[model samples]
Target: MKKTCVHLMLLVVVFCLTTIVQNRAFSELDEGLGKSLKQDSVDVWEDFLNTLDRRGLSDPHWELESEDKEKLINYFKAKIAASVSEGLTSLPERLPSYVHRFPEGMLQTLKSHAENVLKVNPHNGAAAKFLAVEAFHKVNTQISSEKYPLLEKAMVLAPNDIEICFFAYAACTRLGDQTREEALVALERMLERLRGGDHKVSYLWTVRLYTSEVAATPVQIYLKINKKHPIIDRWEVVLTEILAVFENELLQTPDSGVFNIIAYIYEAVGDIAAAQAVFKNLKPFYEKRLAENPKDRTALTSLANIHNKLGNTDLAHEYSVKVNPTLAWEGQVLPEFSPVVDLDGKPVSLADYRGELVLLDFWATWCGPCIVEMPNVKAVYEKYRDQGFEIIGISLDTDEAALRKFIKENQLPWRQVFDGKRWEGPLAQQYGVRSIPAQFLIDREGRVISVKARGKRLNALVEAEIGDTID
Candidate 1:
């Protein structure tokens, strides 16, 4: 089984148990239905019961009562959870491959279960939330008309539910005026409840996850399409509330992982100063922890990460070296290389690009995200090529013909290195590239500067490095 599938199943199991156990909502089993459910081919109900065993509901015939509306809500929750587990087990690893690749059978099964829940209790917000999420994931761009109303309804019915509110908020950003307004109102309602410490809502971790994903959407869209989303102003309202909430949380529980979350949010919104301040504030806490325990792994790791982001490279390396002796630090000289040739059988050397700002882009023809990122990278390259800015394309493509065709068709003007070894290519190994679309921006002095210089940030970094007249 795929690792993603396993992890997702574990998370779903944990989340479902947490919900049911915390709510303490169990019902007597209906004998005929329970027997039929157990005899069902997939045994989802049996798995859910097995999962329920740890909560001391281990009776063989025990199952949720489907007739009771309140119990039915929890019952459907477990049903949806079981369906997801089944789907993950049976489906491909790439869930984000979206509609074209998503199994039609699984989608219909989930849709049917969600619809059944609504039939049992039309007011069941969880069912509405599930359908909204299903619709949100099934499309490529915007939420369709068929899905939008469901999403809007979920927002109205489950305003306190993080997933529902988040999907509704995201969908609204892609929609028209009235719907956007409705989503904003719903988000504000949730924010107010969160501020008031409403127990109906899930706590910090889940809210933080939703906030992080929402914060990242605009950045990801900008990176892919090279356009600031049309609803950015609306996003600002949401971000401001997020910042306020996290800031308040930090004041309540200082020196927590919430610090990292706040810093990430600031960075996502391009508030560099605010982000660095959060990191700087967090530094002393980890530093003091490291001082107390010289070999504290958590402290060492956190300090290293924080210092790296703070541009204190020497400090970052000092902490990182103590943790992992062989780890390379940012701002060190780019690693020396074995002889390699570009796609045209021409020799390629990093040393040749010395005294020029260069971006080493690790990408491949088969990677969808890598292709999505091309337009932004290409635009940055064209804008800065005359001012000592260059990009060395490190193509992790096993098929040289496909790579060549893509390059030629895209009219990419940069030199490209390819060994047709895919992820095992020497250039990728030298940089410890584990993921496609990995990028490193190196300075004129041949020192590694930024590893995540992509999207609009790519243009900004290149322009800052080489687009200005040097004294």
Candidate 2:
């Protein structure tokens, strides 16, 4: 499947992309008094079901009967009725207007339509998922006893659906009971399907699908709830299954997809020793690929990334030049810019710090995550200031007063540059920075060691760059 289709599928799973109630259409449907609403609701039904069909919600491996199609459309009528009665869409902007209580009338309509679909086609995963999402959302984000059955039914109906499996696992994580086992089972099943060759999707695709904000929130909730559980061990098993597939695939084909997924899985699991070993073993495969087809962009980029991760900075840069030298990575020289005045009107330039390890921190005073990370940044600075470590804060804040006030109150000693353009500031645009709290760790030679040094990782990268030990 294409990446765009995968994204749309994610939106559909989270109930955010479609199902907007056209006020006129819904009003007309409402006036019909239930049974007569059917004709007026077909447009709404088509809007919902067509979106699902386009987004790959149904199993492409299975064919739908004519009767099943009718039942599926009816199933969406429940969803439409619920959406209309609640006076809300699942769009992010409409979330503030959410209604907590499921109206008795709305519930009755949903139940009737759901029963209509399930009685005909009990394996209707989409209907089961709709019921599950509604049940979870209606109770003010609370876990209800009623939700478990719907989630289980959804899993049973669509064991191979990654979205449904995610929902099932996510819902299961909320409870403090044996549901943890079920949650793992759901995730394991998802991994099994991805690796079984039944679906043409890759493990990396599954990883990307879950990385989105909407999809990740539930997993975050799971982590928070299961703090005492052996989170790493259980998840490591699921990830290992994916690696097994990659390992087997590599024996036959030196595919970049398989190699990249293997690299990501190792890094995600935090097995640095294993990651080093795997990347080392996989290096020759990419080298041979490039040797045969020197213009293979995928191999060139992958080889550069592998070398960078393995701390082979020189080799990383050599391969990176073959791909795109402008792309920042370990051993790539920091992009040069003319000397610019700092917040205190002192002239500053990266060239001035060519022999000093520096951190180019792009952040704003108004950014919440940046604010939260200030103390940690301060700690790193205080520990390394005398040992040749420096931080250049590129403030992406348009508010000069707030920026200065935060700097003064916090007693931050670093030089800051502000252009009053927020994200449009020159330094930010120069580096293609799209988000804040982004830090680029520069070595003493003015080479970027890492572009994502933040939080606890900041301390590690700074230490590695400056070659210093902090007590």
Candidate 3:
């Protein structure tokens, strides 16, 4: 009775918000290591019975007397009946010592339980994150929640879910803040923070995660750091790839988390066409979803975004008229008028870079391919310095010092910008850069001549028009 009392008390306290995914809709169920063990298995004894099948693994699961098992199950049943969410914070006290027997395997089992039963079963993405917290203590390596596939899926399934997004941010921080990982996590957090007052969250992570996708992180830390610029050819290829990602995501899963990132990627690479496509595709989904559930805040805000994209001033203003409804469809909408930021801590204005050959290049330090063509770009800048070639290199680098040092070392001889804000950087989203080494070639007339072009390679195209080589 004492043991059961302790077990039950622990069960009642810990919980994460959960949702129930319709099982029938999901087709056949998976039962790797007891995750898919039926509801009966949630009870201690039945769970123990299943555990008995592989008694060697019983250390992770309970190995108790029949009576004790019955008591723990009863406690769990009461806890579930009250609310199936208050998940067990930890296994029953005095779990078999041998649990340490298969440390790695046991950790995997707990993770599965967290992902499958806690998160997916009820469709409660929030609850599933708790599983991650538990896994954090169990392992040596810090697991970035952004990189975790489960968190990614949860964000995808529930883009408007704030708690889940917060959980993802926490997870990314736990994962050691690796640039891409930090940016991925930061991207989600940034969108949510930007939308705190109003709106739909962009919900994609890697694209906006600030570690500057276009520029390279220095190989060495200080002034002695080895630096190399990206290969423009690769940038051309990757820019197309990022645009392709945006276009393809819209066509296939329109209004998805990844689509938003692709849109940002497009802008980062200066592929406005591809970026606009994202808003265009999202428009119908938001409108349709709103039509089905006009009360849905996420849907309403998304519709507002479409209006914002189309420059539909009147329609965009109309969505601001909020009326509360019980069941909403998407992200919560706050007040509008959030301005995008440039990396230099300055607000970007479209009117400023007019009448010049503007090359908005987005890159990261970690991108092996992006750094290969920097020399070519440097050459282009030198060749056309007197002529009219303008290169605005926007490093996706989150580290202000490193970004500055990178420019200094490469002797870029161009205006550079970055907020050290990773994926959430204003310019990145304004341009929509998903991958590294993305360059947009803009002509003097202020019209976008090409979405995908290399810094050095496109210069030649421009030179041909002068009727001779720059040399």
lDDT of 3 by residue, 1-471 (tens): 999998877665433212232232111222222333234334443444455546455354544555443344333222222322232222322232222332354446445545555533555443344343444333333444334765565554445544444444444544442433332453334354444332223323323322342232111111121224233334344345434434544565554555656666566656778779877866776777778986887776666666776788667756744422211211222111136445456655435666656666777676677788777777776777667677777778877787778777877777666667776776655454555677766665555555456655667755753345666
Per-residue C-alpha lDDT of model 2 across residues 1-471, encoded as one tens digit per residue: 699999988978656423454344445445543433344444433333344445343443534444434443343464433432222222112111121222345546665766666676575555565566666553333455646788777666655555556656655555544465666777776676566564335644354434432233223434444445666567667667757766776776766666666766776766778878878878888889999999897788889888999999988878876665334555688778645679889888898888888988888988999999889999999988888999999999988999999999999999999889887777776776767788888888878887778888999888876677756
Q: TM-score, each model?
A: 0.49, 0.47, 0.29
Best by TM-score: 1
Error of 1 at 11 (Å): 43
User: Cα lDDT of model 3 overall?
Assistant: 0.50
Q: What is the Cα-based lDDT of residue 221 in candidate 1?
A: 34
| Model 3 misplaced stretches (Cα beyond 4 Å) | 1-348, 465-470
- Residue 55 miss distance in model 1 (angstroms): 20
lDDT score, residue 464, model 2? 74
Backbone clash pairs in model 2 (N, Cα, C under 3 Å; residues 3+ apart or in different chains), count: 0
Q: Which lDDT value does model 3 have at 372?
A: 84
How high a TM-score does candidate 2 get? 0.47
Cα RMSD to the true fold for all candidates: 14.1, 13.9, 21.3
